[model samples]
Target: MPRHYVMCPPRHFAVDYAINPWMDPTVPVDPERAMRQWTELRDTYRRLGHQVEEVEPQPGLPDMVFAANSGTVVEGRVLGAKFATRERAAEAEHFRRWFLEHGFQDVTMPQETNEAEGDFAWTGRLLLAGTGFRTDPRAHAEAQEILGVPVISLRLVDPRYYHLDTALFVLSEADDEQPAQIAYYPDAFSPGSQRVLRRLFPDAVLADAADAECFGLNAVSDGRHVILPVEATALAEKVAARGYEPVFVDISELRKAGGGPKCCTMEIRK
Candidate 1:
């Protein structure tokens, strides 16, 4: 199992601002329901024998609960995030401070519009970063130099799959011995980027329109087990056929703010 850290904010995790297409401030989310759903996801990780850590949420930062965006952790060094929009700018400092106070001393903040793990994903071999949304492509070069690994930049054409985690799922963590696996939605990428994905990950599980629309690609995996949205039937069936146990969870409440399992769970790889 891959160890991950998650956050559970005390305040209502609602879509109070329109950052992505998934957010609709007009519709209010239930605090009790969101907390219950977040707990279920966290509990699922523990039940599967994986270590789950929590980052205490600061009041008024509703989007802080999506821990994956806080930053990308690789080789025990953290390249902290610098969110693209002002709405999430305050999150960078909070996440950096938490990591530092918890013994992560190598945290460095890049002066670029990067939302970290939300737009940058580790695929065992290298890092795949999503651009044209929250992250800037210029930061990709800096990330490659800092990560000491290849960083492939993929452009997202669709606004719904604004983050890389939403369009792609990296099945195995960097520590796993087995070859890495991936799944993605072709429509989420630009024509050139889509071709790159086809040539690179030809065997990746392809999500249908319905499943992609429901955020099926936002699932998280620990090589053998995958935790995904309960509504992603088509993708779940395909994942099961591929020998992965897909644990379906109801995160509809969090979906209101445009996130799912992978968004909340940030795997630490060293």
Candidate 2:
């Protein structure tokens, strides 16, 4: 398993701006509680024997807490995020510099708008890219060329599942004995994309409506172990029965800004 470095923002973490549908400037976020919840998440990763490194957060970048959007890294090389929206454009530079300074090779900035791991994840051999949300389809083409991996584009349909990470869970990237396993919500995807998913992953775990609401697909999996939101009790039980050891982590505060475990943790492939 790859170890990840998560960025813990300073006390400045709050809903200063409404970038995503889940964000509402009127709602108040308790920074202290959010920080505590985030810290505990980091500690949970450490307890699982994964290395956790922190990036010093800037005061104004409240969204920096969702570190996985930083960029997509493959074998130490990176493709810096080019945000589709103006609100997050400033973050592209910050993420690029962090990768360069943290022993990762100088990353290539994509011409098309893409939100790094926020729209891209690995299925071991192929890169499963998401579109019709934060990422553009052109970005998918750019990613395939930049990363030299086959890119499978999945179109998202629902605004509630804004990011692919919110609608699909990559359970097991292809291994020797098994092909890649995924869990996803069909309703969140376009009919064609849902059909594509079924054709590709016949045994995919179809998430229930209740589980999707709790951000069940946004959970993080480290092969045998899965980190699920505390609200996803039913999904947790199902995952356990599937032979994965379910580790529960409460990230209610982070979800207010629209993120879960995978959003905070970006795997560094070495």
**TM-score list, all predictions:** 0.96, 0.96
lDDT of 1 by residue, 1-270 (tens): 457665655354767798899899889788789888889998998999888878878777889889889888888888888888788788889888888888887788997778888988888887899998889999898888877889889999888889988988987645556556788988999999989888877778888889888889999888889899999999999989999999999989999989898888877775
lDDT of 2 by residue, 1-270 (tens): 756665655356788787778888888888888888888888888898888887777777788878788788876678888887776688778877777787776479998889988889888888889998789899999998888889999999899888899988888889788899888889999999988899999987788899899888898888888888988878888778788888888888888888888888777776
| TM-score for candidate 2 | 0.96
Question: Whose TM-score is greatest here?
Answer: 2
Which stretches of candidate 2 lie above 4 Å from their native place? Answer: none
Lowest lDDT block of 10, candidate 2: 2-11
